[model samples]
Target chain A: MRVFRKQDEMTVKKLVTYLVLGFVGLFMLLPFLWMLSTSVKPASDVFTSFENPIKAFVPRETQWRNFPRVYDTTRAMGGGFARWYLNSVLVAVVVTLGQVTTSACAAYAFARLRFPGRDKLFLGYLATMMIPGAVTMIPNFILMRKITEWLTVVAPMVDWDASRVVSVFGRTYDAGRLVGLDSYFALAVPAMFSAYGTFMLRQYFLSIPRDLEEAATIDGCGLFRIFTTIILPLSKPALATLTIFTFMGNWQSFYWPLIVLTQDSMKTLPLGLLSFMGLYSTQWSLLMAGSMMMILPMIIVFLVGQKWFISGIQLGALKG
Target chain B: MAQTTRGRTALAGYLFLLPNLLGFLAFTLLPVLASLALSFYAWDLFTSPRFVGLHNFIALMRDRDFWYYAYNTVFLMLAIPVNILGSLLLAVVMNQKLRGIVVFRAMYFLPSIVAGVGTYLLWRWIYNPDYGLINTIIASWFPQWLSDGIRGLGVEWPPQWLTSVTWAKPALMFMSFWTVVGGYNMILYLAALQGVSPELYEAADIDGANAWQRFWAITWPMVSPTTFFVLTMSLIGGLQGGFEQAFVMTRGGPAGATTTISYYIYNHAFTWNHMGYAAAIAWVLFAVVFGVTLVNWRFGGRIVHY
Candidate 1:
């Protein structure tokens, strides 16, 4: 009887846990479900379907064309969703690749190679992580503007047309507008060197056994060779974690991009989506469709790299 | 030979660090210092910067709008404690070794992963007064008398959530809670819980301690370190946050109901071109963050167990 009672209590406890979990899970999922439902509904149905909760989530007929309609409307408004999508991809990829490479190289130095003031320098990097982005925003903007001014002044002296045009990937670009304000350089360059990434990668690199590097050294291996052959290969998980994080961060980045990119063509997805919202505030269906497009890649990336994402967050908190 | 090799290693180290160092100097270090210097001077982009000593900081003190926005920032941060507790509870539930728990964890974490302007926009739509999800549900599901009772409490029948001045801050807080309840805090707590020794739980069982007792006595103290860490991070982040939400969702609101300090800085710096004032506000924000972090460390360190 005692044993049976204990088993019953255990079962009851498990059931209670499941009940709580399920309730919270439903609360979490409802917003996402509503987003999907709204994305497929006609504009009129958005306000009407709310009278019935079930009907609100299940449209009478899925407006499959709402997706394409968003593309059309945004394109008509001077910024195409496809262009913003490509820009987001390009910026995220560049920032991620650049950050990882720079961070890894720096992490290798900090973790392995002994140098004077290395610890102090690493500490400085760590301390800057606490400084808010607001402090850097104004000066950086000014810096970019100055660079643009300098380029404008020097372009003519070098016999180059600052407004020279080129086209690639079916998109037109000002070939001479290589760097500075409102350019891809503004979007990708400043973000490429992250103290957080360096700190995280350095922590990971410190954990790597030094014996392999030592052995390579004994065999007359150069520092760069050992880093390339051994450290880079071994730190794949760390590299991957940083890559996914930086990509997602840059992809979802809104503030700096908003401040920097004034041209519709230069706008990223978040900015594009915001402008789309501004234009079609009343059109819930189209707005939802635009948002769905913006959110889908992040969801896919999260699902694919969730293991690293979760572990990376945990690793970051370890020091904190 | 040894000295030569050491010098070569140092050279290699500097070489490896060159790219990041240059970027950091130009971007972060220089900008930080320049922002401080700019705070002491007045410049409106086209105009030359004129040093005005402590004028900007003095003006900031007298600026009623700054205080109001600072209050708004703090008001929004009221969600942090609730979020911490909610995530802790969620993490406790997630730390269980039950079947299909990972799916539930993933579901809970979904909102946080999708957090951005898109999520904010979705919430804005959901907070729509006439046709929003919450009001519609309340209108449909609630008994007429209950709705009337709520109406009697001075809130509108379907509550003008994002529209009403009184409800806007609360509405944003609610959205913040929903977004962060199962995010990094929960994951951190889950990691912390997993690190706890099962032997302690066995000992508690031997003492015939109930679930609540076990949690309060053993679990709480064990996870205090993580709690301290989470609290500090959340506080710092909360202080700096609200810019995106204010910009994307409310545009600093119906009547400046959601204008945080960060948004205030943005307006001054970018919109109004009060560069010195904006820089001063940014520096003040940094000071507050620094002071708060120090206090958190001082107090939280005492409570946190190894």
Candidate 2:
């Protein structure tokens, strides 16, 4: 009986520890809860705090129409959300794929290939990571404007006003001639040449054990074969980590996309939502709704890949 | 054979890195170098830059707002260390291997995930005095912080936190702290806790060391590496402060109480279009970051048992 009682006490202690952590965790999570609740709350009940933070969770009624309102309000903005979502998805996917490929290729080269200048070049890559992106924003935007000018080997057929055409970017209204996804190239191409991803991946790839590659070489495996069969499989964790990071970053990107994408039809989510808020300041509920929708995909992605997400973060922060 | 293969490998390596190299040069590296050069010239998005050297730097040194920006940013750096203590205490309690840990970890990590625009909007709503969760709660308890009122229980009314000049900085600090809580630091400390050797615990038990002794001796020493990382990252991020939060929340509000150096720099570059002056502001940030990072790298390395 005494032993059982002691065991019960220990269990209670354990439970208390968990409860304390759980409460703190919930406290950390309050900002998000506040967001979720605020998102669904009726406009009348938004500011009123009774027992809890939000009225939706409280006894007050839920307004499901808020979501639809957000969707409708955003659509009124020249590109609407459908366009912004498409643009964000297109940009993020293309940038992630491009960055991953670019990074993997470079990292592989640096890690496995015995080049004379490789170390120096890798060092050069690492050096650039120290420079803040904000510092580079103005110059990069200017550079993109120049690229739009330079990439007229096949001139875009649009006779338009100089303000819209010559400045920021030019466009062709005729969709029939526009092929191979033009905006995709514009946003993704610059990101494909990202150095930070390469620097990180190179460090990761270098940490990989060399014994397996050595055996593959002895077995007469070609470089491509070894990379395809062995290196690709082994480096999945690093690759996944990079993929997730690049996806999230490109997804949430505001400043760069804001600068380059001039056509209202071509706006990405962050820029689009910001512009929408500016235009529709009166529609507080709608603004919150769009904000929720913008970040929903990220939350879904994180929840789905929580294990990998946690592992990747812990690994990157600690290892780097 | 090895030497020839090594040379071939070098050629192949360069070829593989070509795409990234091109992108880096075009997108990031060139722009950064250009910014350093741009600091010496005046350009307003369009037209050629006229070389007017040292004027921008000179203006930054003399600018009153520049000093104010520095003060606001440093206010955060000063406040954040105190802010992190609450979380550290919580982590110490939470780090125990108890049930529902996964749930707790998820809960703590949710805010960081909800960051950028979403989190910003939430805080903005909460900071709204008339219809905010914070004021309603505070009003119920004391009713003084929101407006003029003395509690019958013998308490003086605090000023409007987010609006009052004296309390504006504190309000901003509190909101920022509340947004993150102990999140990333707790995750780090949790990892550090999990990595502690059981042998150390067993040895301490044999030596008659109590929980406090074991913690100070075994846990603290073992977690030094994680501590170093957290501290360094915190210091780095703390100095820059959060741009969007300040921008959207206060717009440097309540008589520039929340105006950070980064925000000021942003205003110059984006809003005011003082490109040279903005770049000069950026250089000041860079210098400060460089100095602090150097100091941290040295001090963090020295204190870190690893």
Candidate 3:
């Protein structure tokens, strides 16, 4: 009787655990499910009565054209969804590449080389991380504006038309609009040098054994060559984590882009989606469709790098 | 020969660090210092800066909206404790050995992954007072008599979430809880849980301790380090957050009900071009964060077990 009671209690506990997990999982997924359902629903089906919640989620008929409609409508509204998507991709890719390269080189130096004031300089970088972005934002905005003014003055001297148009990937670009407030340079350049990335990579680099580097040094390999062939190849997981993080961050960046990129063409996905929301505030179906597109890439990136992402967070937290 | 090689190594180190250091100095370090100096000078972008010692700081002190927004910022951070607790609970549950647990964890983490303006927009639709999902669910699930009873208490049947002043901050807090409860905090706790020794739990079982007792005595203290870390990090983040949410959802609201300190800073600097005042406000915010962090470390270090 005692054994039977124990088994029954264990079964009850397991059942309760599964029930809690299932219920919470459903609660977590409900909003995404609603978003997917609403994106396919017709406009009339959106504001359903409170009689049947299940019926509210299930559309009368799928409106697959809502996606294309969102695309075309946003394009016509001067904030092209495609253009924003492309810009987000381009900026995220460039920023990730730039950040990884710079951080790795800096990390390699701090980890492997002996230099005066190296630790002090690294501590300075770490200290800056504690300063809130709010303090720096105003100054950065002013700097961008000053740079734009300087670029405008220099463009005429260099015989470059500020309004000249060029085409790449079938998209028109203002060719001379480089390294200024509304340009890609402003969007991608400043974001490339991250103190957080340098710190994380430096921690990882410190863990790598010195034997490999020593062996390569005896083989007459240069420092850059050792970094490229040994340190980087060994630190793939750390590099991947930083790449995914920076890409996701830049992709969904809103505030800086909103401040800098007033031109509709230069806006990223988050700003573009905000403007779309403003224009179609009442159109729930179209707004949901745009939102779905906006988050799809992020979801994909997250799923792909899910392993490295979780481990990286744990690594940083534990080490720090 | 050794000296020459040491010099060469230093040169290589500096060369390697040049790209990042130059950018960091120009972008981060310089701006930080400039922001501090700019706090003492009044400049409206188009005009030359004029020195005004302590004027901006004094003006900020007298500004009623600034105080109210600071209140809003603190009020919004009230969600952090609840979020941390929920994350801890969820992490404890997820640390169990079960079938397809990874899938469940991923589902819980999906909201945080999709967080940004997109998620904010989705919540805006969900929080719509008229035809929103929450209200619709509540209306359908609750019997008419129950809602009638609620209305009899002289309360609104469905809360006007974003539109109403009293409900807006709570609404944003609710959204934040949902987004963050199963996010990185949970993962960190899960990692912490995995690091706990099974021998302790076995000893507790041998002592005839109940499940709840085991948790409080063994699991809780064991994970206090992670708890401290999560609390400190969340406090810092929560104090600075609510900018994107306010900007996207409520435009700082019907009556500035949702405006956070960061949003206030943005309006002052960007919209009004009061660069000096904004910098002053930002410095105050930094002071608060720094003070809070120092307090956390001083007090939290005592409570954490190793």
Native-contact recovery for every candidate? 0.75, 0.61, 0.78
Q: Please write out the lDDT profile of model 2 over residues A1-320, one tens digit for every residue.
A: 88799799878988777677766666676556566666676786664546534433452666778898776766656548877888789889988998899888888888888777777887888766655566777676666555545445446554211222122256433111121222445566777666767766777777889899999989998777777788878888878888888898888776556556656666788777777767865455666778889888987887777777767767767443
Worst 10 contiguous positions by lDDT, candidate 3 chain B:
B150-159
- Poorest 10 consecutive residues of model 2 chain A by lDDT? A173-182
Please state the error at residue B304 of candidate 2 in Å: 2.0
Candidate 3 global CA lDDT score: 0.89
lDDT by residue (A78-186, candidate 1, tens digit) is 4579888988999999999999999999999999998999999999998899998999998998887677666667675552224345678988754324676667888
lDDT for B200 (candidate 3): 96
DockQ of each: 0.79, 0.57, 0.82
CA error at residue A304 for candidate 2, angstroms:
1.4
> Which candidate, 1 or 2, has the higher lDDT?
1
- Worst 10-residue lDDT window for candidate 2 chain B reads B149-158
Question: Which candidate has the highest DockQ of all?
Answer: 3
| Top-down lDDT ranking | 1, 3, 2
- TM-scores vs. true structure, each candidate: 0.97, 0.88, 0.97
**Predictions ranked by DockQ, top down?**
3, 1, 2
Positional deviation of residue B235's Cα in model 3 after best superposition, in angstroms: 0.7
